[model samples]
Target: MDLRGKYGLLIDDIAEMRTTVRIQLADSGLEKCDAARNIKEAIERLSQRRYDLIVCDYNLGQGADGQQLLELVRRRQLLPLSSAFLMITGETGYEQVSTAAEYAPDDYLIKPFTSELLRSRLERILEKKEALRPLYQVLTDKVDRAKALAICDILLAAKGRYVLDILRHKGQLLLESKRNDEALALYQGVLDQRATPWAEVGKARALAATGNEEEARQHLQRALDAYPNYLAAYDSLALLLEKTDKTAAQEVVEKALKVAPSTQRQRRLGGLALENKDYPRAESAFRRATEKDRTGFFKSHDDYAGLAKSCAEQGKIDDAFAAVKDMGNHFGRSSDLLARQAAVESLVHVKAGNPLAAKAALARALALNDDQALDPTTALEIATACFATGDAETAKGIIQSVAEDHNENETVIQLAQGVFLAAGHGEEGAVFLEATRKRMIKLNNDAVAMAKAGDLDHAIAMLTEAADRLTNNCQVSVNAALAILMDVQRNGAAPEKFSRAQTYILQARRANPEHRQLADLAKFYRKLAPPGTPIIEET
Candidate 1:
C-alpha cells in the first residue's frame, strides 16, 4: 500500500486512544487523518469534510457512542459507499455489544490490537471494497438494480478470498431487487456451509418477508441459540412479538437491554412501559437513557419530555420539574424542550393552586411552538392544568382537540373524555367528538377517491403537501397514505413508493396516537418488502 493521499477520521474519548489510532492510520498510508474526542466533534468533522475511512471507538465518553454515531450515519445515508467504517472496541462486554449486526460496519478491530491486527482489518476491508467497487459505484450513484446486480454477478463469478464477501453483496442486491426467493436461496446456501449468525438472521428475515412468522421465529431462535449475544436476532424476535403479545415483546426488549444496555434499547423499553401505563418504569428508563448519553441516536429531547409527562401522570410534581430542569441544562435554549417545560410548569402551578401562573405557563408553551397544538397526551396534560386553575373554556378547547385528532386513539379519547367529565362537560365532549368524527370521515373518503382513481402518487403527494393545511386531519392523512400505499402495491411498483408512503403514515401516527390501521399497513409493507429491510418499531 502506498503511504499517501488517503483521508480518515479517528473518534475516541480517551486521548491515548485517539493518539494511538491517529498515528496508526498515518502509518498505514493515510496522509490526512482527523481525530475527535467525542461524537459532537466527530459529527462536526463529518459535516465539514469527506473521509474515506472512519475508525470509531465503541465507547465514546460523552455525546453519542460509536454505535449510535454509526447508526446515524447509516440511517441518514451520510457515509459514502466507498467509505469504510471500522469500529474499535475493548474486550470489556465485547460479546454483548457485538450484537449490532443491523448497524453493520465494514469491519471491526478489538482494542489492544497490535498495529499488525489493525492493518490486517483495514486491508481486508479495502480488499473487499475494491472487489465490489463496480457494484458500490452503481449503488452510490443510485443506479437501477439491474446494473448493480450485473456488476455483482461478475464479481461473484470470479472470487477467491472474497467469495463469502461476494455472496453477501449478491444477497444484498437480490433483496434490493425484490427477488426474495433467490436471495433466500443464496443465504440458505451460505448457512448450509456454516451456521453463521448473519446468514441465519438473513434467512429469518426472508421468512418474515414471505409472511412466515413461525418459521422466522424458529430461524431467529436458532441464531440466538448459537450466538446468544446476537442483538439483531433479539430485535427481530421483539418485533415479531409486538403484534401478538405485549408482555413477551416487553420481555424481549428487557433481554436485549440486559445483554447490552445501549440508549436505543432503553428508549424502546421506556416506550413499552409507556404503552402499558407503567409510569414509574417508563420514567426510570427514560431518565436513565438521558443521563447515560447527552447526545446520541437516543439523545432525544423527547426522552426527557416523556419522563416529565410520566411523572406528571403519577402526580410527582417535584420529579417532573426536576426532569424539566435537566432538559433545560442538557439542551440549552431548545425550543422543543422549552415548550415541553412550559407545559410541565403549567401542570405544576395548577397543582400548587396558582391559577395565574398556570395560565401564563400554558400561554408561553403555546407561543413557543408558534401556537401549534400539542399531541393528545400533552393536550390531556394541558386540560388537567387548565381545569385545576378553573379555566373550563380553555380546558374544553384542549380536550376538544384531543377528541378530534384522536378519535381512533381510544386511550387518548378516553383520557380526554375523563377530563371533560371531571370538568362537568362529558356530554359536550361527546357531542364534539361525534362532529369531529364525521368531519374526519368525509376527508378520509375524499382522499380515498383520489387513490381509487389510480392516482396514488398524486394522492399521496397532495395529502402530504396539504398536511399542514389540514391542521386537524391527522388520522385522515395517515389513513389516506396507507390506502394509497396498499393500492400502489396492488398495482405493483418499486418499494421506494411504499417506503415514502410509510414515512408519511408513520409521521401521522406519531402526531395522532394508536392508529391501528397504520400498524396493519406497516405489517403489510414489511411482508412485501425484500428481506433484511431495517425493521421499524411499531409506534
Candidate 2:
C-alpha cells in the first residue's frame, strides 16, 4: 500500500461519489487525484496529461460509459501501457460484457464494496501488470511479434501465478500478427492444461481462422454449453451464424442479451429484428435501447429512427412522430439530426394518410440536407421517407449514393435492399445498387491506373473531382488526400502542394473524422509542416 507518488483519475457523474473516491485514493497515499463528471471531460483530462490509474464508474452520466472511454483511450493510444484502468460498477450485467470484450480494463470492482476491497483489487491488478510490464512496453513500441514472442518465452519460463494470463496475451498477439497456426498451438497448449472458457473461445477463433468452420463452431457450442453465460462465445457464434442463418444469429444475440443486457446488445437485437421484418420486436428493442442510452456516449440516433420506422410499419404513426420528436429533443436539431427527423416524420405522416404533411416534411428535409454528406443510417432513413412520400427519384438518388459509398458492406446493401422492398421497388433498387457499385469500382480502378501510369497530377485531379461528387464518400476523400500527399512527398512537399494536401486532409476529416487513413495523412502532414502548426481546422 505504499502509493507515495501515484496520481490517478476519478470519473463519476455524482459529485458525492467523486469526492468519496478522491478521498479514498488520497487515503491510499496518492499525491493527486483528478475528477471528471463524464466521459467527455475524462477524455479531455486524459489527453491533457497522463495518470497512473483511472478509477472510472460504469455509468458516467450521458454519451459514453467507462468501458467506451477505456476503448477510446486504447484505440487512440491516449494512455501509456503502464497505466492501470479500474472500472467500478454496481451492476452485475457488466460481468458478461466485460468477459466478452476484446479489450478490458486491468480490473473491475463491483460497487457497495469497502475501501479495503477496492485497494486489494487495485493492488492485485497492479502486481499482474507489473509482472507483464516488459511485454506491454514492447507491444507499445512497434508490435514486433518476434520480440513479443521472446518476452513471452521469458515470462512463461518463470511459471508464475500469471502464467495463464501470459499465455492468453501471447495467443492474442499471435492472432493480431496473423500467426493463426502458432496462436492455435498456444491455445491448444492452454486447453491441455485447463478447460477454461477463454481458452476454448480462443481455440475456436483460431480454428475458424484456419478454415475449419465446422470444428470451430463445435468448439464454440461446447464452450457455450459449458458456460451458458459466456458472452464472447455467443458473439463469435452469432457472427458465424450470420454468414448462413440470420434467424440463428438473432437467437444467439437474444440469448446474449438475456445474459447481460447492454445498449449495444439491444441495438444489435433491434437491427436483427428489423432485418427480419419483426416490426414489434424491433420496435421494442430499439425503444429500450434509445431510452436506456440517453446518457451514454454510445447512444445512436439510429435507434430512435429505427423505432420510428418500426412504429410506422406497424401502423403506429403517432408513436413514430413522437419518437422523431424525442430524437430532436435529445440530440438537438443539428442539420444532420433535423434532416433525419424530418425524413422520419415525413414517413410517419405518409403512413397516417397525410400526404400534404409528408410532402412538406420532405421539402424541409431536402432543404436541411444542403448537400451534406450522409452517414449510411441517415441516408437510409431519408431514402425510406422519400420512397414513402412518392419521391422515387430522390430515394433512388440517396440509395445510389449510399451504395456507391458502401457497396462493399453487405449489411448496408441488405438494408438498402430492404428499403427498396418496403417501397415496392426491390428489383429496381437491386439493379441500381449493382450499377452504382460497378461505377464506383471502375472509378477507383481508373484512378489507381492513372497514378500507376505516372499521371500523378491527373490522378489527383480525378479523385479531387470525385471527392466533390461523392461528398459523403470517406474512401474517395481519403484517396484524394493520400494522392495529394504522395505527390507532395515526391516533390519534397513543396509549399503549394503541402497546403493542398492539408486542405484535402481537412476535407476528408470533415467528411469522416474517423476514417482510418486520415490519421496517417495527418501525421505525415505534421512532419511536413512547421512545428506546432495545426493541420485540422476546428469546426
Candidate 3:
C-alpha cells in the first residue's frame, strides 16, 4: 500500500491548486511527482514518459477538461491501462466528473479533502489497477485477444473485487472477436445480474453485430431513456441511425453534444449536418470543432474544410475564404495540406460564381495530390472540389481510387458518398461505392481461391500487387502476407520469402492493427520461421 516507489502527475491549470495537490500527494508518501498546468503540457508529458498515476482537475481552463484529456489519451493509447487516473473536482462538478466521460477516470475526489483521504483514494485505485494489470498488459500490447480473454476468465473465476470490470473487458473482447452469440450471452447475463449502463450498451452492440440492427436501435433508445448520460450508448445509437436515417443520426449526435461538448462529436455532427443539408447547423458544429482546442493537437484539416463548405453553402463567402486560409496558417506546409486548402478554396470560389478561379484552384490541388500517398480525407476533399468544378469524371476517378484503397474503411466510404451527395449524385455514389466494395471483396476471394487451388505463384502475385497498390487496404495486405506464409509452409521457409511476408504483415498492421486475421497470421509466422530469422517485432 506504500506509494514511495510510485510516480504520479498532478494536472491543474491553477498553480495554487496544483501546489495544494502536490503537497498532499507528497504527504501521502509519493515523492516522485510531476505537474502539468494545462492540456497541452499534460499531453506532452504523457507522450514523453510513462506515469504510474495521474491526478487531474476536472475543470481545466479553456473548455478542455480532464475528462476529454482522459478520452484523448485512452483513444491514442498514450495512457497505458496499468496507469491510474483520479479526477479531482469541486462539489458542483462532481456530477459531471462521475458521469458523461466517454473514457472514465478510475476514481474521483471532491475538493477540501485531507491528505489522508487523498492517500486512501490513490491506494484503492492503484490496487484495482494492479489487480487488472495482467489483462491490461495483454490489452495494451498489439493484438492478443485470446490471451486477454483467458485472463478475463481467470479473474472472473477468482470472483475478485473487480468482477464487473473483468466482465466488461470479456464482453468487449468477445464482440471484437465477432463471437456474437457468446458476447450476447455475456451481456445478457450481466444485465440479468444487475442493470448497469455499460451492460445494456454491450448487449445492444452484440445485437447489432448479430444482424439485429432494429432491435439494437430500440434497445439503445431504451438505454438512453434510462441512462441519458451514457456517452457510449449515444455513440452506438448514432452510428446505427446513420445506417437508416442521417437526420436522426444528426439529432442523436446533437443530444450527445449537449450532454458533453466533445470536439470529435462536433465534427461528426458537422459531417451529418452537411449530409442533411442543414448548412447553418453544419457551420456552427464545424466552427466549434475548429475553435475548441486552442492547442493544435486536436485541430484537423477536415474541420476547417467542413467549416468552409458549410459557410459557402450558406453564401458566407468571406467567412468561407477565411476558414480556407486559416487552415494554411495552423498546419505546417505539406503537400497534403496544400491540396486540402486548394480543394476547399476551389469549392468556395465555385460557390461565389467564379468558375475561372475555381478551376484554377482545383487544378493546383489535383497537381499536388498523389493518389498513392494522399490521405483519404484530403483525397475526398479534392474529389469534392472536382465535383463542384463540373468535372464529374475526375471526381469519380479520384473517389474510385480512394474508395478502392480504403474499401473496408466505412468512414472513408461514407465521406466519399457525402461528396457525391453534395454534388447531386447521391444514387450514383451509392452504386459506385458498393461496386468498389464488391470488387475489392472479389479480388481477395479470387486470390484466396487460387491459393486454395494450389496456384501459389499466381495467387501470391495477385495479392502482393494489390497490397502494394492499396497500401491502406488491410484485407489485401493480410491476404498477401497469408499467401506468402502458406508458401513458406509448403516450401521450406526461405529467408527472403519470410522477409517479404513480414513486410506485408507490417503493412497490414499499419493499415489496421485490429484486422481479424493479423494476430493468427503473425503467430503462424513466428512458429514457422527459424529462431535466428528476423521476425516481426511486437509493438
Candidate 4:
C-alpha cells in the first residue's frame, strides 16, 4: 500500500526510535512525515496541522505519554475520526499496558518488533479505517442516528470474514441512538455463544443506560473478575460507583490506576478525592496527573483549580496563590476560575488581617460576571469568602440564592444549613428554608393542575413563563417542567412531541439537582425516541 499522500506525525522521546520510525514510514512510501521528540512539540505540531497518522511512544519524559496524548486528542476532538493512532509501548505485561484501552487508540504496537510487524499492524488499521469510512464520516459529521444506522446496515449486508466487526459497530451505533433494548439484545446474542469481554461490557453499559445500576455493577464486576486486566470493565464500574458509592468508586479507580497508572485514571481518582473532600489526596492525585501527562487530557486549568482548592483548605496560602497565578497565566482569566481564586485569596487576606483586599477580590469576581448569579459551586466559595471576612449579610444572601436554586439538592441544602449553624443563625436559617419550601410546593401544585386539565400547551407555556417568575424557586420550576414532560411521555405523543418533552426533561435536570423520578423519566423518554433524531427544543 503506497502511503505517499498520507501525512504522519512521529512522536518519541528516544532519538533512535524517532529516526527508526521516520525511516520506516518513509521507506513504506509515506513521504509527508513530521517528527517530534516529545509531547509538547507534538501538540504544537498537531495544533498547526492535521495528520493522517500519529505514531507516539508510550513513555515520554516529563510530558504526556502516548496513552495520555491519545486520550487528550480524542476527548478534545482534536484529531479527525479517520486519523490513525498507534501506540508504541515497550511494556510487555498486560497489567503495564492495560490503561491503553481507556483511550482506545486505533492500534497498538509492542516495541522491539520488526519493521514487518509495524507494517502489518499499520496496514490492518488502515484497512479497517477504509472499510468503515462511511460510518466514520457520519459519526464525524454528527449526522442523525438514523442515517448512521442506515450506513451501518449497508456495510453489514456485505458479508465478509469481518462480520463480527460489523456487528460490533452496529451495536455501538444502536447504543448511541439510545436503543438500549436492541443493543442489549444484540450483545446478549453475542455473549450466548462466547464469553466476549466487549460484548459483556456493552451489556453492562446498556444496563446502566436503563437505570439498572445494581445489575450493571454486577455484570461489570463479573467481567472484571473474569478478566482482571480488562480496563473497560474498570472504567464502567468506576462510573457506576461514582453515582452510588464513592468509597467503592475510589477503590475501583485505585485498582485501575494500579493496573495501569494512566493520567486519565489519576485524574478521575483526583475528582473522587475532591468530591469526598479529601483535600490532600485530591492534591496528590491531581498533581501526579498533571506531571505525568503534561500535554494530556488531564492537564488543564481545572487541575490548577483543584490544586489551589486543596492548598487553600490546608491553609497553604502562598502555595494556593502560586497555583492560581500559574492557572491565570496558562488560561487567561476565566470567570469561574477567577471566582475560585478570589475566594481562596479572600481566605488568605482574612488570615493576614487584610480585610480590604479580601473584599476587593470578591468584588472583582462579582464584577467579572456583570453581577450575574454565580453557580452553586462558585456561590459556595463566595459564601466562604464572606464568612471569613465577617460579612455575614453578603454570605447569607449568596447562601440564600444557592439554597433556592438547589432546594432539592440535599447536599447543598445541608451545606447551607451547616454554614448557618456555624454562624449561630440556625433558627433563622430554618425558618427561611421552611418558607422557601412552602412557596416551591405552591408553585409546583399550580403547574401540575394546569398540566392535568388537558391543557398541555398552556401548561408548557405556563411552565416556561414560570421559569423566570420562580427564580427564587429554581428547583420547583424544574420539577414542575419535569412532571409535565413525564406526563407527555406517558401519553405516547408524536415523535416530535416526545423529543420536545425530552428536551424539557434535560433542561429541568440541568437547572436543578438530581431528582430520582425525573432522572428515570428522562432516561425512559430517551429510550423511547428513535436513534439519530434531533431532540426538539421546548419553547
Which candidate gets the maximum TM-score versus the true structure? 3
What are the per-residue Cα lDDT tens digits for candidate 4 across 1-539? 54668889999998988889888877677788899887678878888988888888888777556676777777666776778888888756424554445457777777677777777777777777778888878766543567878887888788756667768777887887789999999899999999988898889999889888799999999898898888888888998887678778988999988777876677778868866778888889878865665544356655776677677667777877787677666555657768867776776676556789888987766565445455566666777677777888878777766776666676677667656754567798788777766766676677778777776666677676655533444455455446555565657546566555555565565554334455465466566667665553333
Clashing pairs in 3: none
Summarize candidate 1's per-residue lDDT along 174-262 as a digit string, tens digits.
Answer: 77566888889999999878788778877887787778888988888777888888888899888887656767778888888877777
**Candidate 3 segments whose C-alpha is farther than 4 A from its true place:** 451-455, 485-495, 527-532
| Weakest lDDT window of 10 consecutive positions for candidate 3 | 94-103
Candidate closest to the true structure, highest lDDT: 3
* TM per prediction: 0.68, 0.79, 0.94, 0.70
Q: Write the per-residue lDDT of candidate 2 for residues 1-539, one digit (tens) a residue.
A: 45667778898999998888877776667667888888778888999998888898987765456776787787778876678998888877367436746667888877776777777777777777788899888876544567888899899999999988888888988876778999999999878987988889989989988898889988898899899988879998988877677788889999988876677888888878877889999999998898876554556788888898889889988889889998887775577888888898888898889999999998888776557465677778888889888888988878887777665566888889879977888798788888888888788778878887888899999998887777656678777877877786675656667666666676666666646566676777766676544456444
Q: Global lDDT for candidate 2?
A: 0.80
lDDT of 3: 0.91
Model 4 is weakest, by summed lDDT over 10 consecutive residues, at 93-102
Q: Which stretches of candidate 4 lie over 4 Å from their true place?
A: 92-102, 315-318, 347-360, 371-539
Better of 2 and 3 by lDDT: 3
Cα deviation at 139, candidate 4, in Å, is 0.9
